[model samples]
Target: MSEWDSGKNDGKPGWNDQPAAVADASEGKQSRQDRKLIDKLVMSMQVEQRRSRRWGIFFKFLTFAYLFGIVLLFKFPLGQGLESATGGMHTAVIGVDGPIAADELASADNIVSSLRAAFKEPDAAAVILRINSPGGSPVQSGYVYDEIKRLRAEHPDKKVYAVISDIGASGAYYIASAADEIYANRASLVGSIGVVAGGFGFTEVMGKLGVERRLYTAGESKGFLDPFSAEKPEEVAFWQSVLENTHGQFIAAVQEGRGDRLADDPRVFSGLIWSGEQALELGLIDGLGSASYVARQIVGHESLVDYSRTRSPLRNLVDQLGVSVGHGVAQYVSEQRLELR
Candidate 1:
């Protein structure tokens, strides 16, 4: 049979046989071209993978640099933050905000310690205390008040004044009254000559739920204010006496610090709060002004050295990152507490 009609499916012998010597070289060249194309494609993929890894490394370095910058923010000195263009005069600000808590004060581990160090600066013309608080522990507030008084007496020529940003009530006002001059915005809240103790009444709900409060105490009134138990009338009277005594002390402090400046108003100590404008007319503050205005107009400088433990970069970053999440958690907890019957 002719090779073309062969039963086996093999190619025809004439066509399938290796190329003649003349055309053999061309076949070999074609095979090599195919192999080269495949090799080139493989090499390109490898190069792209390496480039991608290089890009990843570059981004990692950039992240590290950003973290380093955050660190530098906390490590730098006070005067470093302010620009030099504010002129030759340099004023210092000691911000006492948040609560009258021991941690936030001018004590050993508090704002006061930071101020003590900052006030030591020779070039600072005046030290301004920026107070923004609703008041807290009377003892803590009194501690800060006494320190400011002592510092002013020591630094006679260097003016140490206060500028209440928003709310400076009760204990906060007690401290502010000690300042050489108190300044506040027209809308800033100024005074609340009062003391308060707060707690929830859960006795009715506990009865509804058949929740019996069991306790063993050596003292007769040990758990006096416990929510699960009905509060006694005598205990109520005793607590009222305590509040009245504390309120009296708060009133005396304000009167002593304000001296002849305060108006002769019997209702000033009736647990009432006043706005900054009303406070000024009542002689609680020397003037109505902001920190910047007070500095430029009175102290004559926009430059200020913050006498606070400038937060660390790591801490600041954590605060920035955690603020939203922390707030959400706190809000949820508060809502749950509010929902409880």
Candidate 2:
């Protein structure tokens, strides 16, 4: 090989342009380059993180501001037909449009609150309930009914009326009975004055499927109504008595509210729902009319104001999330056994 050629080195000092030293130097330079690239990547990641954090904060603030605005609107009544303290006469309408339960839209709290607000309004000539519900929890209906009675007694000059649109059965009818006058359309369903508790019997089904039912409770009668177990006669009698007492209370309330206007019909409190036309004959309802008709004819005020309390979007979203979680837990529980209360 030529002396200047560094292709193949002979066994000599300083041979092949110190190839070992040259390779070592190149490797050291590559190491430095790698460190620089790593540092650059780290800096880019930090910048991206900061940008993401800023956007997250912005959206959170936007959401909070939106919810705050809704709260303000609800509190201040931002031109949703709210009248001044000295404004002229107008009919105030509060809507009850769902099952009567603690957490439902037509709950006692919402209805009573709306009623109080409508009653407090100086320009309100009268208060009206626009009802469309299949009824629910008797306790919730009782609360609303009691409040209506109290509010009526407190403000005897201001009359409260119930106008049923679709279905006002059971607890809905219970609440409507407290009104000064109950009105329904010709086709509206009006009454189901009774108490009922029901559940399926799964003892035979479990036997057929060869599935075991396991239950643990501290009280002997705690699981009395378990579907997988045979029902005790004493427990059944106790439950029937409870239903009878509740039904008696319902009948008494109706009698007190309707007075002599109610026709002497045993079928009225027999858990049978009746059409508005049939209801009138039975004196379950006083008249046939819509909300508009009540506002114009009864209140003598054409302009109507709605005092219905409604859930905000954010609240509704939270409620939906809770319901989803509750459903999952309920399904898990139902798989174990069918419970009746």
Candidate 3:
């Protein structure tokens, strides 16, 4: 029998030796399949290696960029850099804007620091307080006024002027009065020589809503000014006297600052705001002009340098974060109370 037919025919090939050609063809097919599988695995491994390398490079660059940004933010003294950049013979301006309060931009601490820095500059011809504020916080205004006077006395050579932009009233006017000369635009509103405290009475509304205000205090007058409590005539009179005394102090400071320049009008210190022309006529302001006009015409220097202090970005971020967290906690508590109800 032929070698191929010598195999068992039990529905399968025999275990004996097969034909050489058939065996050779089967081995070639199996070798080709093995080669294809190996090639696919190698290709997959190459692709994976390339992807891993690309991701590794991306992460390295990202980490480097983040670190560089941190270095610039924390390691650099940006304030000093700004001061140095303003080098030259120029008029240094410290802005007194917004509500002059402890936490505001126009706070006493910020104004005084800016003034000190401006005055320390050798090339600064004069220091100008560029004011545009409705005013706030008597204590803050007083602190700024005292600092200006002290600085003026300390550096008589460096003249300090006040240039009113739009409005300089109450506490703002108080600060302006300490200047060597007060200038303003013809249309600018100037002067509000007074002290004030404001609040709203919510006792009647709370009573209508059936909301009881449970307040306890050791002193009888401790919670006297609470909006939910009824106004007492005695408390009212005492608060009025306090306001009047504060107003008196304000009038005295204005008089001392303006000296004989103020007019003999009784309404001048009656918390009245006047136009720049009227202010000049009343001697509340020295002249009708702007900062640019004063810098060019009065101080004889056109170059103006701002010495305004600002909170750092990081500090501002931290403050905002804290505020956000507090707000979130308060909101959560409010939601919990609503859920309970």
Pick the TM-score winner: 2
Q: Give the per-residue lDDT of model 1 (tens digit) for 1-341.
A: 76644533464355434357548898899999999999999999999999999999999998997778666765652222243234455888877776665433332246567556556777778878788888776777777777777877888777777899988887778778777789999999888878877667788998899898897888998987666688889998998897888777777777777789988888677767888899898888999998888888998867776765545555456568776577657644543110000
Report the lDDT of model 1 for residue 185.
92
Q: How far off is residue 169 in model 3, in Å?
A: 1.4
Give me the runs in candidate 1 sitting further than 4 Å from their true place.
1-89, 103-109, 323-341
Model 1 scores what on Cα lDDT? 0.73
In candidate 3, how many Å is residue 29 off?
A: 33
Q: Let me know the TM-score candidate 2 reaches against the reference structure.
A: 0.73
State each candidate's clash count: 5, 0, 0
Candidate 3 vs. true structure, TM-score: 0.71
CA lDDT, candidate 2, residue 2 = 69
lDDT of each: 0.73, 0.84, 0.83
C-alpha-based local distance difference test score of model 3:
0.83
Q: Name the candidate that leads on lDDT.
A: 2
Give per-residue CA lDDT, model 3, range 1-341, as digits (tens): 75446775655665464477688999999999999999999999999999999999999998986676576567642343146245579988888888787767788888998999988888999988999999887888889999999999999999999999999998999999999999999889898887666667888899999999999899888986777788898998998898888888788888989999999999899888999999999999999888889999999989888887766564455566685577557644433110000
